[model samples]
Structure formats: C-alpha cells, structure tokens
Target: MSFEHVFKRIIEFMHADPCGNFRLMVGTDSQVHKRHTVFITGIVIQNEGKGVWACIKKVVVPRKMTQLHERISLELSLTEEIVGLFTEERKNELIEIVLPNLYKGATFTMEGHIDIGAGKRNKTSEFVKEMVTRMESMGVEPKIKPNAFVASSYANRYTK
Candidate 1:
C-alpha cells in the first residue's frame, strides 16, 4: 500500500478498533547531525486495554538529550505563537508548512498543549469550557457533562 493508504488505515484502525489500544510516539533515531531522521513508534496493546496501554507508554529518548529534543520542542511550541502573531490567513499559511507532518509527530510538544489548553484554566469546569469552546468553533456543540461521568465513560470503554 502507498504511504497515504497505510497512514489512513492506521488512523482508521485506531479510531474503529473495538479491542485495540494504540498510542503514537514521535522522536528521532539520532540527534547529532543536522538532517536527523524522524521516527514514529505506533504501539498496539490489547489486554482488556489497561495493562497494554501502560505497556505502550514508554519514551525512546531520555531526558538528558537536550540539543535536538529541545529544538524540536521549541519548534512545536512556536505554532501557536505564529498563529497568534498572524491573522487567520497567515496562520493558515504557517499551518500549511507545519501541520503536514504534525500527525506523524513532528513539531514542538507545546503546540499540542496550546492547541488544547487555550481558555481552560485550572479547574475541571474550565477544561470542559475550553473543549466546548473548541467544538463550537468547529460547528460541533458537545453536551456538557461532569468530570466523573467523563471519567466513567473512559473507564467503561477501556476497562473490562
């Protein structure tokens, strides 16, 4: 299969699989050189989905690797900065360059958090508010619910 087909299939499997738990980790194999190769580790674990999910939760790189890891982190962090600095048009331009590889796990990790954490403050209510705001922005009005219910839903889906 072509890379696009393989990528789509993997995403579909992750979304549709009833008994599989998958997590993706992005990193580089080597960092000493300029043209570092990006690596993606897609882990699948199926153990009533609990222990398997934990098993897949391992980082390939240690915290000590600062030079390249930090660089990648900064680049990832810059996405929202660029978005904030430019209007929607310029932001879309920047996204064109940056977003193509984001699913493959290339960008500053901060980008992910900023994309998720904008209006959400410290409280759980704040988190729901932020999520709802995003869904609204996407023309999706989600039903607001309590954290306990949301946690229970996750527990139900993943736990046996």
Candidate 2:
C-alpha cells in the first residue's frame, strides 16, 4: 500500500479513539555505512504508554555525509514529509471526533524525536540546538536522547 493509505488508516484509528488516550509520535534515525547512510523515519501511535502501533520508511543515500549541515538538511526534508502526511482537514476531523466541544477545532500533540542528544559526546550533540529549533519551527514538538524513544529506538531498528 502507499504511504498515504497507511497514514489515513492510522488517522482513522485515531478517530476511533478506542484507547482513551493516544499520542502520535514521529521520529528519525540514521546509521552511517562505508559508502552510504541509511535513514529511517518512524511514525508511532502510542496508547498512553501501554502499547503502540508504528510504521517506518527508509531511504539510503548514495554517498557518505561529511558535513553536519548537509546531514541536517536531509533530515529536515524527510521530517517534513512525515509531518506533511497529515492534512489539516483530516486531523481536525479526528480531533473533533475525540473532542466534540472543540468548536474552534482540535489540537493534537505530535512529538518529533530527533536521534541526536546533548547527554552524549557525539557528533549529534553539536546539532541538538539546531534540531530542536528546526522541529519547533515546523510546529512539531522535539524530543532527544533517552526521551526520544520513537526515533532512537523505533526508527533505529529499521536503520540496520
């Protein structure tokens, strides 16, 4: 099936609101290879920390990345695609279903988990601030390090 179909399925699941509380999470993780880099993005529908429904997309670059800016640019593009998958109309409908009194519309919380963290001495640390800002600017909440399970754990699984 196409990504659009998959996203719509998830959105329908959200509209059902069966689990009482649900959280939608989006995150990306990448691994460097000798000649190329493997990038994976994970979208998760979490059920109040009890369980989750997840999907992932992967892409492999043709060459190794040497610059932080270049790597971040690629991440940005992939992140945008994931965020853009949900249309405002569809999202509002789902939210309205969950919150009937939401005449002004509904608000759903999405956290974009970045694979980079400041707690470690890694290349990603230098880019933490930039990534946090990038995520905020895109209207998605940002998470990093141990708190970023969807990216660091869920998406990281597909990178291998």
Candidate 3:
C-alpha cells in the first residue's frame, strides 16, 4: 500500500529464496491536483538472470483490474512460468557460461549481489580468495583497499 511497505515485501521475497524467482509489488508516487496523490503499482524482478541464469522467460502486467480474482490467477500463472524456465539443463548451461567468464573479468562486477561496502564476511573472504587465485593464474596482482579508506582518500583530495 505504501512505498516502504512495498519495499519491505520485495526484500522479504528476495530473502525467502535467494535462488528462486518471486514476485513483489512496486509503485511510484506522484501528486495530481495539489493533494490528490496516486501511486502506480508495477513489478520488478530481483536477482534476474543471476546465478545459473534460470529466471522468468517473460512477464506480463495487466493494466486493468477487471476482476477481483484475476490478480491472484495472474500471479500464480506467472510463478509457474518462471519455475518452468529454470530447468536443470538451463541451469547447467548457465553455470558453464558464467564460471569461465568469472576468470576472464568479463562478468566479475557484472554479476554478484555485493554492495560497494556491505556484505557478509564470508562472501568477502571468498571473493578475495577467488580474485587472488584468478589473478595469480593470469600473472597479475590484485589491488585491495577498504571501501571507507578509498572514499575518505578521495574526499580529502576535494577538501584540499
């Protein structure tokens, strides 16, 4: 109903099954006529085309709520469609395509759910380990720095 509420729901769906496709409500806020505010509901896919690339093949949003029960039916049908797309063979192909790209830097930053300066310690450790291994294989060294340190260094340059 509200922006924050909707955002919470989306996050919940994302966390429930980090590896599966899920639906959540999205909306935009705008004012019409001084005080008549309208929130347009929409949908967005999270973690789309991520690990294994098994995701919704397509999504259709209905603009009109002609029937009260139609919304539930649409949601159920869409969920099934998404599940069907994530076949085992597709998942294997996705991994084959993705893993090689990781070593080549072609998909290092393009994928991964890590924030600029936030994530679980285990993920960070694994990333560092993989990067070091990959770089060593290619005869290159990695450049490592804490995000806050980097940000402060840049900020100091502007102040001076």
lDDT of each: 0.30, 0.75, 0.31
lDDT tens string, model 3, 1-160? 4434543454454444444432221211111223222222123333435422111122334244343234323432333333333345543443344354444432211111111122455333434454334323432222233432211232222212
Ranking by lDDT: 2, 3, 1
12-122 per-residue lDDT for model 1 (tens digits): 444343333333211111222233322221122122343322111112333334454343343223322222333455324423443555666433111111112223453
Off by over 4 Å in 2: 16-19, 101-107
Total backbone clashes of candidate 3, pairs 3 or more residues apart or in separate chains: 0
**What TM-score do all the candidates reach, one by one?**
0.22, 0.83, 0.24
Question: What's the true lDDT of residue 96 in model 3?
Answer: 44
Better structure of 2 and 3 per lDDT = 2
For model 3, the stretches where C-alpha displacement exceeds 4 angstroms are 1-70, 105-160
Candidate No. with top lDDT: 2
Assess candidate 3 and give its TM-score to the true structure: 0.24
Better of 1 and 3 by lDDT: 3
Name the Cα RMSD for model 2: 3.3
Q: Which one wins by TM-score: 1 or 2?
A: 2
Candidate 2 per-residue lDDT over residues 17-37, each given as its tens digit: 543466778887777788999
